[model samples]
Target: MNIAGDDMAMGGMHDEGANKNKSFGERLVSWLGRVHTMVIHFPIAMFIGAFGVELFGLWRQNRDYQRAAHVMLVVGALGAIVAAFLGWFAGGFYLWDRNPILMTHRWLGTSIAIFGIGLAYLATTYRRAPDRSRTVYWGLLGLMTLAISVQGFLGGTFMHGGLNHLAF
Candidate 1:
């Protein structure tokens, strides 16, 4: 195995140039970026809750749950966009080199945000469109759920020690 790959996998390397610059706006943006951790939960919870509500809507024949799910999807999508923007600030622009985990998390988070927005748009058109639209919406929501789970794991690895975070 490549020693360099091992080190990156173990979270042994990070943005070496971090916290070494000197710009007030940059520092403030970085400070705001740190809030990415907290702000991210809104979208996560919203998306999960939206899915739950949709499932309940089917089970209980409650039209209200469907409406609630739609609203949640909108909120979740907006939250995702904001969270991704802040995450970029948090991760910095270019200091990370050859760090796969950070790179993956950064792009994955961004893709999720874009996907969430698309899902949100679909939600808005769910009722007016054909049956295929509903199918696509549900299918995308299921995929989004899976993606969010993976995203959470990646973010968690940052704090808990990469692949071995659960080694007990």
Candidate 2:
């Protein structure tokens, strides 16, 4: 209820963005934003795990490992969709020009989500991929995994006030 800076000065309310006038859906989204950070880890872990197992599968020439990777990729893609949706809520709607870090993080996360889903579809569609196509798929998965790492870095930079957060 206290949307003004005065109540925040007294440590009365933690959420300064709260608005009593907001509709049910609006408030729901605002509340959901708080869960974004927690949900993001699921997809990141899933994707990284997928990439690692895929590499091991290729190295060992194992069909089991490849199947596991495909499953992981699908799950990771689903998680990414949820994480990115919550992230949009977390970052606020269309404030792209107002904050550079948020903008980059937001778009990058979104791209990953889109790309992840596409990759998942392709992976599922071509379960018994030929050698060449499978190779290209693995390469794309590697790139997506790399992008996830960069997204994590950007998120940290935004939260901890830039790249010097780890300064000695």
Candidate 3:
């Protein structure tokens, strides 16, 4: 009877341990989900705002509006970096091998990150001095705007086309 009691106790302990592990994974997944939602919108908003400023600048030939557009691009790029990090983590945790869409999403996400980092570097270096030219500023804005367009297109494609895995 003593041996039977010992077996039961061990089984109880195993159940508790399993529950704890599961709870930890659940918490991590929940946190990642929240971060994903939080960081994604900022980039979308910033990119749209940057494009608006650029259009407005061209329409009015206002240097101030153009400068605002550059600032918005930089802010959007920074947000993209944060969102990519969280997205990468979540993809690895839950969808890496399970879904082709996740794989395509990861690739597009990485491309977006690289483009954003490059844009940020260009913006920072070019704007570091007080004597930066309006032309240079506009050029950087154009590059950033192009990157944003590509990133947005790829994101949409990944979502709508299922990574191009299915044949129509």
Candidate 4:
């Protein structure tokens, strides 16, 4: 029962054959590399911008700066989601359990991803009727700031500590 000019089952034939064609290790490595490339980078830029805007807003006490920071935080959160997915996939596929650091990294990455999603939701909702709540925006910004800091620290721990210490 070919449906799209392909002689393969809807869910099995093509996928099974494809899997059989490539060694599992090779496939995993390829997938990890691809997802890693696709997900990393944007989050770094967005978060950096978010941090900057927040600092500027605090210094200037300007509503415009605060709004800009919120926008960047929302964008950064989206990027973090993509990065988290790829990082998670890579960790799982590679069985990155040799060190405790990997677990810490995973937890921190997940936290950042979740926080970002929340921030994005808040930003979207707020955009519709912006003047509704200054407290909400400020609260979200504070959370974003904390998330970014924690993510950064965890990333450093992943790179340097190799999961040796669980101290936060």
- CA lDDT, every prediction? 0.77, 0.78, 0.60, 0.62
Candidates in descending TM-score order: 2, 1, 4, 3
What tens digits encode model 4's per-residue C-alpha lDDT throughout 1-168?
Answer: 221112123421234345566778756654653465356667867766766776676688765775676677777887888888777655553434555656666777778788787876776676667567657655666666676666666655544443444565
Model 1, CA-based lDDT: 0.77
What are the TM-scores, per candidate, against the unseen true structure? 0.81, 0.82, 0.60, 0.62
Residue-level lDDT of model 3, residues 82-154, one tens digit each, is 8887776544444344455455566666667677667656656655653676466556556656755655554
Candidate 1: which pairs clash?
Answer: none
Rank ordering of all candidates by lDDT, starting from the highest:
2, 1, 4, 3
Clashes of 1: 0
Cα lDDT for residue 39, model 1? 97
Compared with the true structure, model 1 gives a TM-score of: 0.81
For candidate 3, list the clashing residue pairs, or say none.
none
**Model 3 root mean square deviation, Cα atoms:** 11.2
Better of 2 and 4 by TM-score: 2
